[model samples]
Target: MPYDFNQQIIQEFRANRGKVGGPFEGARLLLLTTTGARSGVRRTVPLGYLNDEGGRMLVIASAGGAPHHPAWYHNLRADPRVTVETGVFTVEAEAAVLEGEERERLFARAVEADSGWADYQARSGRVLPVVALTPRSVSFPDLPEGASPPLHADRLDATLVPATSDDRAAVMAAIRSLLAGAPALGADVTPALAHTGGVPGVWVSAAGGSATGDGVTLYVHGGGFEHTQPALEPLMACRLSEATRRPAFKVEQRLAPVHPYPAALDDVVAVYRSLLEQGVPSDRVIVCGESSGGTLVLSALLALKEAGDPLPGAAVAISPLTDLTLSSRSLDVDDGRDVISRRVAEHVTAQYLAGAPADQAPQSPLHGDLSGLPPLLLVAGTAEVLLDDTRRFAAAASAAGAEVTLDLYEGMPHAFHASVMAQDPPAVAMTFLRRLADWVAGSRARGRRGC
Candidate 1:
């Protein structure tokens, strides 16, 4: 195709949101943008694509059988980072050149799907290269087309206190079983080591995320306040960055039995203050964390409010441990049904608290005043032992005059959103991310930058 011809099609496609008229009208296609391997200049070209069931876009580099691989192919071979405009939205993707059995199988399938691929291969006298573009972010709609947020989410009616018949050994057994199946969700992230407010951590970006952006999503990982998943934390942070559409700083806070009580909490607050000092608007920033990380998020809010510091626009806690007291009833009622029993909770709380009073405000965020805080999105599963931790926190935050949105997934275990880390994740996990995206947008719309 002539340079002028490709330019016209690009203009038409952009104007029509992925559609082109004349010979290409209504064809399934996407705009592929690749960096010139040598010159480092970006080039965009429209290509016919096939939807692979593994969540990848398949493009054949036949180049009309011209006996040489396409320029884009060589460009991607040098640098796999590519930008794809699917007309739904633009996202960053990593280009993987298919090879061996996977290549033969997909190429065969492409031929079966369209004889044009076979015709091109025959004319080229060389095997066509098949490339798969796996999006670095998990994109989802705000709820399914027919779905809607419930008007009210009533608390689960199960008993809070434990029964004498509950066996400790049985509870431990159940905890181990449930914890074993916890989804290891995460993304392919690029991380750079940095210190925010003198607190050491990594700035992470989802594979295709932009680090040069102004706003940031501050992410704190969950590890029961004592342990850390060094290898997996970056992956999780990457996903959060993608979900919120911002570069993320994954805090490496001090752990328990060593840097107990207020150490970790202080780290979160310090990093937040660093963002504000660096000129990132409070409203443009998002503080999101999971498990104990979520606990720190809420605690940080209370601390910030007490000190008259600015708060982020919004927050999301994915199954946080709000009460170090371990007094939530679901710890007993949902005991064996979920992972991590009362014993584990007690050990974690004792270690992190290290003689700090559990009834105090920041230590036990569930005990503090939650008034004048930013909009919050709390997610949990009904099958988790911390169900009540989520339930009680939502109830208290709402009662304390804070904005709250509790998204519950029934029959899901603790930290269920971790499942979204997989290449092809379950619907529930995608829904969690979609809901977060919508909630974040809504928070920005209302300008809920906290005081």
Candidate 2:
């Protein structure tokens, strides 16, 4: 309705080479400069785009479901030629509207990739238009002279090499050392050993003034399931404790390529059961983790449900790896943007699964029955390779009648919340941590009131 907001976004987009702050910071946005149909003056608008099969870039003219078509859409209809800036690269493209089944199919794919499009459509009683922007020519400057760049250059980093078993101990030690002197953020750090349901683990907590009697958080760390980092998990545990004003436990589980498949899962389940047996009411405990640790938290919930065991009050999965199959579009779209890689996924899958089917329940919880699980809060960054995993899982879980809340951070990377202190202004990670704490505390309060 107003050009002022669009103008501000346009300015940020141009200044940042496609990157913009605020809600759209980490989102996939492209600046479309079009020739006005009547005015004939050039007009620019920032829109989200999806990469289609035939190397075509797809943009939805949902206009947040406005009654009339967006001005840019009308401009494109009159003049097919358009200028597109995808943050990373600028290109000349021809836009063509899709109709009938093609439009429906692509729209469905967009909804699957991001449910926000569906929400926009639902809010307005109109058929959203989909336009295909086929590039006239692709350019790549960083590639070797003879090497042709792929259809899309979304990845900003090179492919990573997977770590082997020999690197496990050293990696763990280094992470532990880095987190050894981590600031508690006003909480006191305490180290303790615990045995949950006969499974032993190292328990670290942030207590004292910040501690509350409401409940506790079980913090799981992520290292591709191959190794356990003592420092990182403890640091996260401390943050959780401080944020929630409750004690937090960092459970140490066996690593894969050594214990494999059900080993880590079993250990976490034991810890959960032990918490229940130790007089912690089921509704007072919150289970949470990042990366593979997130996967473990979800899998444990499934395992506990199947076994008729009590469930926790709520769960939080941060940039979790839900699909062992490694089949998410963001994996390709975020290849260079994320630190994790296909090699690491394959390596971790091999080590953890140890010949188990990729879609096996409890191993790949996305394939498991999500019913009966407790309320889930999933946090993921649009820039993460596992973005699709969290999105798909949240969608599936919600469809199964589970209480699921998915928070898509615009531009965060994997485990962005793991750091005790974030360098960015607004400290998005710390904000998320505090949000998690509030959610957990609220859940407990509701339960106590029998709400």
* lDDT of the candidates, in the order given: 0.73, 0.71
In order of listing, the candidates' clash counts read 2, 5
lDDT of 1 at 332: 78
Model 2, global lDDT: 0.71
TM-score of each: 0.58, 0.61
Candidate 2: segments with Cα more than 4 A from true spot: 1-194, 207-213, 421-426, 444-451
Instruction: Judge candidate 2 at residue 195 and give its lDDT.
Output: 41
Candidate 1 ranges with C-alpha deviation above 4 Å:
1-195, 207-214
Q: What is the lDDT of residue 408 in candidate 2?
A: 58
Where is model 2 poorest over a 10-residue stretch in terms of lDDT?
155-164
Model 2, position 143, has a per-residue lDDT of 18
